[model samples]
Target: MYEIVAGIDKSEDRGRAIAESITEMPLDHGEVRVTLLHDFQDNPEGASVDQVASVRHARKILEEVGIEVVLEESSGEPADAILRLADEQDAEMIVVAGRKRTPTGKVLFGSVTQSVILGTDRPVLVCSGDEN
Candidate 1:
């Protein structure tokens, strides 16, 4: 039962690339239980239209590789929400994507990806958003 937790932003611009990078990672022939999680709720009662679109896009990518997935949405701190889900699922890996930020900017306003990496002992696979 190999499980993975992936955190993503459902932005119109770069969400597809992030999802593609995660599913296209080199695999050693094991089926994955992928949880495609998006924490894009200010009031997390149900899936927003954009969140639904993000999940739909992500599912197609993972399914192409024969990996089954479930979509989940959460409200609250994005980084904390991701960690909680990973811990609950006992995930083997955590995948997150982010753009390159300046040191000053990072220090002033810490990033969700950075926070997740530092907060957990699990292996974090960071997919940079600058990829073409």
Candidate 2:
């Protein structure tokens, strides 16, 4: 079975974008499995991965298309958690949502998406968070 680990943040738009991109793939219903991963750097409320809004949105979309979905939570740096989880899951690919940032902005604020792409040897799929 083909395996994919998707790292998603709290943005609903990013989740939707990721889901839509996955749905566009021409895989059979049961041929692939997707793991939705959320890294909680700080969670005072003690929320689970499934409780994340973006994760939930992505889960619904993926489930509707008959794809197997797993929700996993990690607590630490997002890129590190994502890479660790992807390795643990032995995923064939990694998926992440990208934010629109200027070069200066990226320089000021390091991007999790950028980190994931640079840190992984496996294939990485990046989906845009913007609607348009």
Which candidate has the highest TM-score of all?
A: 2
Per-model TM-score on C-alpha atoms:
0.82, 0.95
Residue ranges of candidate 1 with Cα displaced over 4 Å: 12-14, 28-30, 41-46, 49-51
Candidate 1: which pairs clash?
none
What C-alpha RMSD separates each model from the true structure?
Answer: 2.7, 1.2
lDDT of each: 0.77, 0.91
lDDT of 1: 0.77
Evaluate model 1: give its TM-score: 0.82
Query: Residue-wise lDDT of candidate 2 within 1-132, one digit each (tens)?
Result: 899999989999999999889988887858889999988988999989888999999999999999999999988899998899889989999999999989999999989999999998999999988756
Give the alpha carbon lDDT tens digit for every residue of 5-115 in model 1: 888776523456656776677764247787878886565466563446656776777777788777877877889988999999999998888778899999998899899
Q: After superposing candidate 2 on the true structure, give the runs of residues whose Cα lies further than 4 Å from its correct spot.
A: none
Quote the positional error of residue 129 for candidate 1 in Å.
1.7
- Return the clash pairs for model 2, or none: none
